[model samples]
Target: MAQRMYIVDDDKSIRVMIKNIIEDNDLGVIIGQANDGEIAYKQISSIYPDIVLIDLLLPSLDGIEIIKKVKNEINHDMIFIMISEVSSDNMITEAYEAGIEFFISKPINVLEVVTVIKRAIESQNLRNVLNQLKNTYSIDSRKNVTAPITNSSRRNTMKIYSELGITGESGCNDLANIIEIIVNERKTNNHFNKYNMKEIYLELNKRFYSENSIKTIKAIEQRIRRTVIVALNNIANIGIEDFSNYKFEKYSSVLFDFSDIRLEMDYIRGKSKQRGKINIKTFIEGTINLLKD
Candidate 1:
């Protein structure tokens, strides 16, 4: 069966454009459309949809309110895509907290609409598959352990770093440990600054080598830099395969500078490009945020 979708926007033009895009891309079928929040809420409450493309501002009631109401009343798996013209961080954060799967900034470009919907669909499918696997495993497993599944901080760090494709590198474990140290500093020290980064790097050196010298520190730095480069290349390769891949979409600009990521991507995709630079501080800070959040 085709995936079900509903559009909730006051702009008739946007509704038409998004409808046409959905049809053109064969991105499921539009089950309903509403120009007001109350009607949309009523429609969704009567029958749940697989996806909802909703504007932030709507008639009768606001979009965020509709999300809260529908999510509270409707007991079904649904993907909510927020449509908006404004780029306020607070609005975006609120929508995320409200459980929106994606956002489409208004004056909606056709390509952006298609890409965002496609990625959302892919993620929804992946989630369904994982749920199925979980169910099957639950039924297949006979013995139940009394201990809870606890992931150590090290393990969590490794998992996050693996998203960047650096888990297999020689210094990945050390790098993960170093990031944990940075996160700790961020949590504990109000005076933590970039100047303290050298101390953190040296601490990493202490974990690997008995004698810490300029040469060894440089070697360790080089290894880490190379590993970070490898991670960037890996994400770029994933982007080259599918630009809308959630991993690439989420981390490409967050983990590294967007310009650098784009250059690496262009090069990977056979475009003539110059050597790209990585902002180590930016990458570290981004990783720290990713871990903390």
Candidate 2:
């Protein structure tokens, strides 16, 4: 069956353009559309679309309110993608917390819209598969199963590093070691963020080096930073070539700030001279999040 979608933007032209893109790309079928939040909520509740592309600001109520209502009141599975011109982080965070899967920034870029919608559909399908699997399997059957070493977190970390184009870097091992250490600590504390970068580096130095020297700690930091920079550049290059690339879509926003990714992408395109800033802590936290997911 074709995936069902609904558009809830106030602008007629925006709705038309998105509809055209959906049909042109054979992405999905638009089941309904609305120019007001109250109407949108009613329509979405009635039709139960597989995905909804909704504007942030609308008549009657706002996008966040509508999403919250539907999620709270209706017992249905749906994906919500917010369309907005707002750049306020607080509003965006609220939208995310309200259960939005993605954001389509306005004035919309066609590639971005198409890519995001495709990703949404992909996510919806994956959820359906997982649901089916859950229904088909028994908890007792799963209890005795053990994942192979090849499927371990360490291997998964290496696979992700390879996808980010950092597997060959000198600090790849150090990065993996750091993640392992964090994972081990998480088994007890669970609040991995409580440990700072300095403490992490100190732990690594104590575990691997003969002497607890500041020089070794600095070297470790520099090496990991350089490796992370290489991963950023690789992601930027992938984005420049194809914004819809799965790796680019998945890691760009999670591993680093989207703004930094954009900066790196622009620099690669010769549209900007400034390079992206690397936040090592953000990268580490993001990686751990990915691993957990």
Candidate 3:
């Protein structure tokens, strides 16, 4: 079944533009539209759209006020998205507390709106699946003491990392195994079911690396290492395939500046090009800019 969406905005042109853009992108069925909050409330109560897109500046009642009112009186199941030109941090925070799932700031690009909506839909669908699985499983930790996950979990995790282009991810395969072994050891000894991040990190390092973990923090080191590795890989393999014409044109500039990953990739073509050592910066910065939200 196609999902339903409702749009609420005071300007007719903005409303029309959004509806057309969404329809053009084949996003979903636009169930209804409202010029103000009052009309929006009525349509929402009667039609029950699966998602609601609201502009902050409306005619009578504003979008934020509408969100609060609807939550107080109507159902809270539908996802809410706040669209605004203003960058009022406090208002955005308050709207978040009131249960807006996401935001798209204006001047609204249609492409961005589509991306946000798709991401939100994906999240909601995943949540629904998780809830269904929880109801179906009725997990019993004591049933088989320490039975391993039956191949399915491993396949699923690998598939996920692969889909996200993280096949070369180091920690997911190695450090995580170390941590899992530590947890299993604790469980076998009948230890408590609680462990802090620092304690877990220390235990993992002590067990696997033969060195005490840092006392200062949580999974910060793990995240940094994994992210840096990913950044390095992405920058090196930035262009998925090499076009014969553009290989030495567009990518040559990228390679000339960042010799880290490109230099390594060069060695893969031993017969085609001469060999060279590839060493990415121990501390570099441009990589982070590419992966920023």
Candidate 4:
């Protein structure tokens, strides 16, 4: 079924333009529209839209206030895209705090709005799939009595890495472990650190207590580089087999930089001899963020 969306803007022309764009692009169907914030809240509560396009400044309650009231009192899982002319940090921050997933600036561009909403919807769908996979694994574990049920998150993480054909590589587990540690550290600090190879290696070295830090870090780096290359090659090979393979379509550029993936793809198709360079920090950080989500 097409996802239902609601538009809440004080301006009728803006609302109609948004509705027309959504319809033209076939992004989703807009189920309702409200000119006032309070009316939007009531209508949203009644319809339970999958997505909401709301103006930051509304007639009665304002966008942030309406979001806060709805999220706190009525619905919690609805996706919100804030439409605003005001770019004040305070207002943006407040909207984000109140659960806006994206922003559509004034003089809305059709492409940007569609792209942002589609990306958000895709993320939500991916999360739902992961949850279903986890639940299925849980059910199967309960039925079978042999091996103990491993951590589902870890299992899922490993499954993703395994799909890229890196499970047997020397540093794969080490990378996974360090990613877990980094994610935990982020949780503790309530913020994500902008990671560097040296800093990450130093942290891992502390945990593992290697005899020679420099040598061990170098070895670790090499191993991870090889493993990431393997993953890139795997995606490229999949792309070669079927250019529109869903796995390749979704992961080709996301797991690595697009330029790097393009290089790997060229190599796979026998167009280039230059090996793709994997950004180790980016790979690990992206994997950590992916698994955490």
- C-alpha lDDT values of all predictions: 0.72, 0.80, 0.55, 0.72
Error of 4 at 189 (Å): 1.9
For model 4 the TM-score comes to 0.46
Q: TM-score of each candidate?
A: 0.47, 0.48, 0.45, 0.46
Q: Model 1, stretches more than 4 Å misplaced?
A: 137-293
Tens-digit lDDT track of model 3 for 211-248: 34343122324432433344333334443354343423
Candidate 4: 10-residue stretch with minimal lDDT: 132-141
- Cα lDDT tens digits for candidate 4, 18-103: 99989998988676789998888987765456689999988878999888876766533568899989978987988899899899
Instruction: Give Cα distance to truth, residue 163, candidate 3, Å.
Output: 31
lDDT of 1 by residue, 175-196 (tens): 6657666666666984355645
Q: How large is the C-alpha RMSD of every model relative to the true structure?
A: 20.6, 20.1, 19.6, 19.3
**Total clashing pairs for each candidate:** 0, 0, 0, 0
Ranking by TM-score: 2, 1, 4, 3
Q: Is candidate 1 or candidate 3 better by TM-score?
A: 1
lDDT by residue (1-293, candidate 2, tens digit) is: 35778999899999999999999999987767899999999877654677899999999989999999877666345799999999999999999999998999999799999999989988887875664333222233335543222237778888899899766554666777778778877887774648789998998777554556766677667657756877887898899999999999989999999999999888767788577888888898788888887
lDDT rank, highest first?
Answer: 2, 1, 4, 3
Write down the lDDT that model 2 would get.
Answer: 0.80
| Number of the predicted model whose lDDT against the real structure is largest | 2
The Cα error of candidate 3 at residue 43, in Å, is 1.2
TM-score of 3: 0.45
Residue 129's lDDT in candidate 4: 52
State how far residue 280 of model 2 sits from its true place (Å). Answer: 0.6
